[model samples]
Target: MSHAPTGARRREIWLLVATFLVAVAGLIYELIAATLSSYLLGDSVRQFSLVIGVFLSAMGVGAYLSRFVGEALRGFIWAQILLGILGGFLAPVVFYAYAWTGAVELPLFGLLIAVGILSGMEIPLIARVLKEIGAPEFRFENVLSVDYVGALAASVAFPLLIVPQLGLMSASLVFGALNLAVAGLSLWLFRSDATRSQWGVWALALLLTGAGLVQSERLVTVAEAALYEDDIILSETTPYQQITVTRFRDRVRLFLDHSIQFDSFDEYRYHEMLVHPAMSHASRRADVLILGGGDGMAAREVLRWADVAQVTLVDLDPRVTGLFQSHDDLAALNDNALRDPRVRVLNQDAWQFVEHANTQFDVVIVDLPDPKNLALSKLYSRAFYSLLMERLSPRGVMVTQAGSPFYARQAFWSVVQTVAAARNPVQVGAGPWTLPYHTYVPSFGDWGFVMAAPFAPKTGDLAVPPGLQYLTPAIWQQSHVFGADTGPIEADVNRLQSHALVGYYLDGWAKWFE
Candidate 1:
């Protein structure tokens, strides 16, 4: 009849706090699982297939097992114990298993299922625990609200707090320890549910697994290193995406989504072909818009003209832009192009930037990576070209890094055809000079760009700029020559699944590797 004492009221608040903690642990498990999958498998398709497959399979099993759980909170306690043990070890185990067995897809799928199934039991079990502890008036909606709020907190912290500070390996253990804390809370609150001996063994298991995972950071790094053949010089994971640089002897390669963007070793071969032909014809007037060469090497070339008033570059990655802006070694490579007061670096995606530009340029250099997949394919699409064409001044030329004429013939022409389809009647050309270094994984070869404009592009000798070590007229001249073996093949530029071009890219790489 009377209100409960203050001590009794405090106990209910603690139970609600316990509910929040367990919900957070479950979400942390999902995030780490999904993130690792995305890293190991490139974004386009591998991650979705693996993560979704595992979660759905595990959900089915969780639903199946839920029917068998006993009346006591003991089942829920045991579930957290199992979840903590599995999820704690999940990151390091998945990484090492993939490296050892070479069946990345297998464990990648398996662990996701395990985490998902365990996570599914959490809500029902926690609700059951609250009810058994004499909190029957706690409405379903109230408990659900607590669960959902806890999820929101976990979502915010996992990326900003967990990943950046703790990193993937340590973060997994930290979350595992958090899950153990929830289990420990249940043990203290409900000693009557399980025997003392059983609780002791479960606690030992949880402690051993959590402590064991503390050393997991070393294994994850070693496993990742084993995945790549080259020496990984730098790897950064931004909230947006992954940026990796790998070096093999003389070659320093930049990779985004496991697709090679440029080899510092052979970038000149690609950049010279991309710039010189248009640079000479377009240089006389001096207006330039470069889309997506965040490395600044292209800016190094575009800024050479004394007549050029301004060079505006649009790249999506701020870190890349900032690196060249401040990092001394990189600045030297790009001739400090980002610092050139004449050059303006706009940190934005090329697609959105090109679509919305109000002004036109004497030259629009579309320096985006190849459209090996749909995300990049959009940049090469007819719609994107139309926007680009809209922003080109008369006599203004825009060049794209067309797949490859040698192997990705269809893909190379699809760029040509799409530009043609893009209402610009674009003229296409090929240079096979960069074919020697095609084993960069997921992509192949330094290639060509379709030169699209309102009129035929003027062909002339390359004018070597001062302060340059790589570009010359002779290299420019030879860039146009395609040999008999690696010359044009029947292909079309990629359009969604008409990935006739991706096939060509893959084929070119296969031959180059062979």
Candidate 2:
């Protein structure tokens, strides 16, 4: 039944190998574009959702254009070459474009469409080449299946191998060369095609460029120097998060997406705001729970109160706590906070930890991040508040960093409402001044807090820990009122999964680069 000969089988195997490379190129380009966007932008889920939407739409447009593809082999060769050039340079183009283009997005949508169309058209062209060379009709589905298998390989390899090993720039270039290799193979297989010589030049350029980048790893760091102002002291991409520690002498800073988690110089303001108020208001305080201060700033604050018999701090990232434990500069910031004798550090997601908390606290301080996406927003959800309520002793106080009451006003109140609805007496508070720290970061400004309880305080007249540089009675008093910086807006519709901060962050921050 099969018309194809053994010699043809050998030739077809080589062509399939070429198709495998093409598939790898397409997938890496798709994932790299999505990955870079997720890295630069704060929310991975939102960035990836938009990227997949745009890419799929563009791929549909591309597939429709395949009907007009007349010179099949020539067009396919040119496509591979172009993909090599464009995909290889995409990372740098975006990085530099962020600095150069004062406004208007890097036409990432347009690039997505261009690359997606080209990528979508790849399989059809491969099938056409195979059919022209006397391959049996039964082989069509098998060829397509092989193409998808290669794509799966690329997907598994990109995040796990390529990215961590090569980083953005080098990885792009290496994958670009892979595209060029596909072009060269296409030329060898289909030498009669008009695009052969052009493919040669593209292949040479891609190989040389990729090999050059392999040697210039240090230059890559130097190039990244422009994006960050301070010296790049520590940079790592952990499974949970990207952590960057930078320093300007005593002013070491930990940044999660351009948002300051802590600055060695002045984090006392943030920690004091997060911990002391709730602890001071606690009724006969003895036990304490801190939800998310992996850097151990709040733990240091909690340990100061002599009545606190045990302080349990739950944070998601071990690397964060590890740094506070091991990194010299980090330990100095919190004054060896996590190492303190009374503290028990549980490195786990507070969302999961609170579910299993058998022990209640006199004071529960929620030092969670602002709800940027669904995963984070749920921590601000009514369900999570119910858990918090379960973990608080009767007549105890819980406080949280409710974000900027001005910029994310409704987002801040959403936390309060979620808590209030959870059968807790949610007492709201406000204060605004992180100054130039949060000012440059999107539309973010004017930070605040929320205090909630099942009943009134038992230790309302408690003493302050001696080392506090901020969180005085006056600052605590000012932190309670909602004065203009943008009064509360649309609290009810601020769903956790839908994530209101997504809109606010994009709008407010998108202006700065422009």
lDDT of 1 by residue, 1-514 (tens): 8776554345456667867887788778777777777665544454555575667578668757766788637776777777777787787777787666755666656666777887777667666666666774777678779888998999999767777667666777777777777777767766656668658867797768656665565565586687667888776666545677777776677776445777776676667667656666663547799989999978877777677888999988898888778978667768899999999999987888877788989888888876544566778776777778778776777777776666565566556666665654233342111111111112354465667666655555666667555556666556656667545555454454454544555555556543
**Can you list the residue pairs that collide in candidate 1?**
410-491, 410-492, 410-493, 414-493
Q: List lDDT for all candidates, in order.
A: 0.69, 0.71
- Model 1 global lDDT (CA atoms, 0 to 1): 0.69
Give the candidate number with the greatest lDDT: 2
Angstrom error of the Cα, residue 65, model 2: value is 2.7
Write down the TM-score of every candidate. 0.82, 0.85
Per-structure clash totals for the candidates: 4, 4
